[model samples]
Target: MAKMVTKSILMPAALAAALDAEARDKKISLSELARAALSDRINLAAIESRLIARLDAQDEAMAKIIALVSSLEAVDEPEGGVTQ
Candidate 1:
């Protein structure tokens, strides 16, 4: 098991009141609420990072496809401008 450590943080009075109100509204202790909030934020950041990486990969793939398409030469017209 990991050891738990206690730390203190200072916030503006208005923010502190808001956090306290939220914890009370949820019927949880302030410590628990803060922990949950921090965990949620960390999870959100990880998700955002993965989304960005996937988007970048897609962009690279599309760029390659565009380059391949642009490199191809146009087909010549059929003789007499008509096909049999």
Candidate 2:
């Protein structure tokens, strides 16, 4: 049975005296330290959007292993005794 809402935010007297000295060093209550700093900035923006989609899938798997090592260095052999 908990539901009590009230609104009015205009901080800036030095950020409301640094959110009232961080709600008196965590004893909480400046509205639960502004709802735990807005729920830790919405859980750090959902963990930085899942670490930027796993760093864009490891940069598309290193661009397909640098196009298979530039197509095996443009193959070109067989000049004397070996071409198998």
Candidate 3:
């Protein structure tokens, strides 16, 4: 047997009606529809977090590259391209 858990949620009347209609179309209970919606939200959050982390890493790498280029530019070059 499966266990059941109860939760309370508040939503705007229009949104609630939409959810009910969608649930009816899917032939699923309102509870199931709500659970699926919540699960989808959790999945989206996880993906967004990963994307943010990757962007941050890329930004850090770019900053390091810029610093290296600046340091090379600051070096003094001999009058001649090659110093014998």
In TM-score terms, which candidate is top?
Answer: 3
Residue 69 lDDT (model 3): 91
Between candidates 1 and 3, the TM-score winner:
3
lDDT of 2 by residue, 1-84 (tens): 111111112222434555576578667778876677687832434444454454456556766888888766555434553456
The top-ranked prediction according to lDDT is: 3
- Deviation from native of the Cα of residue 37 in model 3, angstroms: 6.3
User: Predictions ranked by TM-score, top down?
Assistant: 3, 1, 2
What are the clashing pairs of model 1? none
Give lDDT for model 1. 0.55
TM-score of each: 0.40, 0.28, 0.43
Compared with the true structure, all predictions reach lDDT values of: 0.55, 0.53, 0.57
Error of 2 at 15 (Å): 25
Please give the ranking of all candidate structures by lDDT, highest first, separated by commas. 3, 1, 2
- Minimum summed lDDT over a 10-residue window in model 2 is located at 1-10
Candidate 3 CA-lDDT value: 0.57
